[model samples]
Target: MGPDQALYVVATPIGNLADMVPRAVEVLQCADLVAAEDTRHSQRLFSHFDIDTPLVAYHDHSDDQRTARIIERLEAGETVALISDAGTPLISDPGYRLVREARNRGIRVVPVPGACAFVAALSAAGLPSDRFTFEGFLPAKSGARARTLEQLAGEERTMVFYEAPHRVADTLDAMAEAFGEHREAVIARELTKAFETFHMAPLAELAAWVRADSNQQRGEIVLMVRGAERKAGATLDDESQRVMKLLMAELPPKRAAAVAAEITGVNKKVLYNWGLEQK
Candidate 1:
């Protein structure tokens, strides 16, 4: 029997076309239809590889009708390939709705991975990668953006974000404000492309560099910020302290410390001592 027809989510090169994997090429070549975030932008890659598969536009703004059409095609035993303008689809790009709809319709979804900008940047950003968060894009407005950063102020995991050239400086400034000027950060620009640059510095320095150098502000950018450092001898966070205080009101200090330790993963002794200080 022929291979089961499926929806292939292909990862295209972020910048350098050479990063496209052989399997991704094969999938796209064999796809009965290719759903691209931008038909014109993907056309260059298709032409470069000489793959003549029919292209359809499917992106963030695509309506339900468009997604329904793709699902209908997938249900009809035709293999469809989904691709973003660059990197994997649905990574701050479109295609989530289409993929979800296709799955609901019992269409098999296959991933043909290749290059991802954030992954590429994190791998080289010299930041702790054991645990991380991909916060795609921050709010464009200053107040909203600051509030968002404030919410993540205590995030201990490495943070990765995609930012537009125009807002890089402002985002960096807000990050410095929320995460602190001394927080280490890496700004990766035009990754995998000619003139690619990765600048590593403290948040304050990075913000200053971006503000001073207009060239650094222009490009496809990935901003990686080091996680919040746990202060020595002060392992319990503010939230844990608050929890401990609330527990102290209901229980004995020792019992409250023990409960807070269990709940917050903080050391019992630390919570006990902190509880004493609060009283």
Candidate 2:
């Protein structure tokens, strides 16, 4: 809006052009400059929208000199728009440094959000969304990826990640090996495009599906995994205490067992028996 006094982090469509928000287009068109992950990619987008703002490259591989140039622009009272090749910038993309620098200089940062693959997949994943974590892109090397997965083995919140087509199968295999074959997962591909597809199944089945069909291995992928189902820090004895407290509230033993099972996904029959033992 009103001549943005700082950096504008704009989100473009991941695949479909129509998903680009009008406010994003206006900011990109009117900004003093547009810093993109790839100048060539941004150029194409700009051409399509007939927005001729100057383009500069700012990516993971770029040098400090490039970031310095962008910071200088913002310091000089210029409103710069930062965008990624697709989707939102700085979500496993660059622009963090520029934003940080601008903030240190007291520049305002405006985020125009739209068309995030992770959010899209999560919303349709039918998984628990109340608590979740985004892991962005995983490490490319096998050992690093394995170690990463092992660290998240006990995590309880749903996790989201982005994986390239070439490595999707391998990543799934690694996940299965680290997390277990029966772990639930969903893979969303070519999102918001003509051939968009969502594939959901156990980890092993998904691995096999990707292996059996070459076509399934193409296009960007958003992978969602159900977090490990684990009890809280409380032990079996602590659970017994919690159940006792609830039962004391006059909730029937069967209803108490059902509620406890729903809370922990523990065996309802076992909990019911425990309730009897307590009584």
Candidate 3:
């Protein structure tokens, strides 16, 4: 029997239907009512799982009255399952209002966790995961997007963003301009579907590649950008990095890198790679 007087925040599959959890299917099947972002779209999922539970539309545009109605049912000890069009609800999808109000009214809130797109992309992006930030979607317009990226130029955490298929190329261009062209990034597209891809390259190359191929511009996209390099040398100390930069202005790249390495006890190859990135 489904737990009553509680909201089960259910996670739906983003692309591949196989990712759906057995518990989520059980909860929905036994729920007294299923609150969905799109009732029609959710109908397909229900039909597939043979979940004949009633569905009520609840989304960003859901009015306070609509929320009041749902809360009323929950208070009456009815089981309500919340599911978005895809993935976990409220991760850039709707249902936050209902969940928020449910908690305020002392209704139980349970998470039936499963697939989440960003979490999956970050796991294999090859970027630092220890300390990362989820920035969600950036501004859609060029000027606004530039300003937003400019503000995050110094972010030390790996940045994650979702972008529409058509605007991805322009967004990558803006990111390359804001961050250095050499900054590394990954494009995860069509996630679990047949055309799934995870292409990682320097920002400039990635941007050019996406621009050149119309195929890269299509499908769901997750963009992961490496954080800004710590000014201190990867192999050397801060003073060594400063000295190497100063010497390169006057000496040849090879000579300056060699001199810096000899004086600082740092690897010459590492110093040389730094010089190449600067150029």
Candidate 3 yields a Cα-based lDDT of: 0.90
Q: What lDDT score is found at residue 50 in candidate 1?
A: 87
The Cα error of candidate 2 at residue 212, in Å, is 0.6
For candidate 3, write residues 91-196 as lDDT tens digits: 9899889999999998999999999999999998899999999998999889889868866776778999999999999999999988889999999999889999
Steric clashes per prediction: 0, 0, 0
Local accuracy by lDDT, each model: 0.89, 0.85, 0.90
Model 3 lowest lDDT segment of ten? 228-237
Return the top candidate by TM-score: 1
- Give the runs in model 1 whose Cα sits over 4 Å from its true position: 1-3, 232-279
Q: Tens digits of per-residue lDDT for model 2 on 1-279?
A: 445667999999999999989999899989999888999888778988999989888898888898888888888999899999999888888888888888887889999989788998899988889999999899999988986886676677999999989999999999998778999999999999988989899999999999999888999899999988764343355765586567646775556768888786777756655554455
Candidate 2 local lDDT, residue 125? 86
Point out where model 3 deviates above 4 Å.
232-279
**Could you tell me how far off, in angstroms, the CA of residue 56 lies in candidate 1 after the best superposition?**
0.5
Instruction: Score every model by TM-score.
Output: 0.83, 0.82, 0.82
lDDT computed for candidate 2: 0.85
Q: Tell me the deviation in Å of residue 38 in model 1.
A: 0.6
Candidate with best lDDT? 3
Which sequence of candidate numbers ranks them by lDDT, best first?
3, 1, 2
